[model samples]
Target: MAAPTPVRRGAARHSELFDALVELLLTEGFAHLTLDDVAARLRCSKRTLYTLAGSKEQLVRAAVVRFFARATERVEAAVAACATPADRVAAYLRAVAAELAPASARFVDDMAAFPPAAEVYARNTAAAARRVGELIGEGVAAGDFRDVPVSFAAEMVTATMVAIQQRRIAGATGLADAEAYEALATLLLHGLARDPATPARPSAGCRS
Candidate 1:
């Protein structure tokens, strides 16, 4: 496989300002956060803020990057802990289902409500897709997933989850329980379950 590309960094790369902006954005929404407010939160000057990350948009993008970076760490750690490939994939999705934060949901809504924000979100989401695809490839290597196109299957799972997240952001989180078992069950029915032994566990249905 070819090497994945990397993203470039911009001015105003101070980690402190980056974090403050993310927190403010999370609590106040990007629409309400201002550079001045961010400076105040960080006990810094407007000069310091501008010297580092530039406009609110840049700061916001940095925040998104930081958020996903941290999330990658957590999800990777979760995926690594499972005993088998099937279990790892299950653990990975479950971790994603469980990782939704109100701030993340709010960010999704705010971005969809505004065009430029939507573009930033699109870039971030594309990066996220590659990460998810890598996880699926790992599962395939372990013989826990069907021998199919990893990127496409990964995309299917990623797109479905994005739809779920968007619905959650829109206050239309359709399920009664956030456990996401219904989707999990659906995946199993569609033969996403890689471990043949998995269905045999009391949850068995349609096992021949």
Candidate 2:
């Protein structure tokens, strides 16, 4: 049999690299990140680093995206595990808070110092808002939520989350990720709740 083609040596998923990236981002902050630090932390060669992730910028962006995705997945699972709509919403917030550990807190601070990464982050935030708007709409249809402007509501929640992140870094008047999620959910739900005094409104113009 012909020998199998040589496996090209390049970056694998490299969980270690991602973990290291996150750890350093927290300890050193973003602007101060250097490949040498990651290599030192991982005790890997600089050559291995290059093969694993291209540049500091690439690594930071990838690590942030991957971290958030993993966090979201776990939070989604938490939300699914709840039996009541109220429970599910509360659990979702907690899950989100738990995901924003101290390390993740530092990533945003660092991202702000770099314009290119910052722009990527801003775009990502908008995408996240659109995706979450869909979930809020689902709640409304189930009668668990009142009709609210879906897009606007989602943007408000996302903006609030950003503020929470900033607060976490500031170490003053901090809201744990879970706490922020719960408070926001409650605030939104209470405002949008249907009642004798408040008729059910339709989010007719809201986008899918």
Global lDDT scores for all candidate models = 0.60, 0.63
Q: What are the runs in model 1 whose C-alpha is more than 4 Å off?
A: 1-13, 102-104, 114-117, 130-134, 137-141, 145-152, 164-191, 194-208
Worst 10 residues of 1 by lDDT: 199-208
The Cα RMSD in angstroms, rounded to one decimal, for candidate 2 relative to the true structure is 6.5
- Model 2 scores a TM of 0.69
What is the number of backbone collisions in each predicted candidate, taken in the order shown? 3, 2
Error in Å for residue 4 of model 2: 15
TM-score of 1: 0.64
For candidate 1, the per-residue lDDT at 109 reads 64
lDDT of 2: 0.63
- In angstroms, give how far residue 7 of model 1 lies from its true place: 24
lDDT of 2 by residue, 14-130 (tens): 665677766666556666657887778778877877765688777777766776667668777876776545455555665665665555545656666667666655665555455
User: Which residue pairs in model 2 clash with each other?
Assistant: 97-177, 97-178
Runs in model 2 lying further than 4 Å from the true structure: 1-13, 149-152, 162-182, 193-208
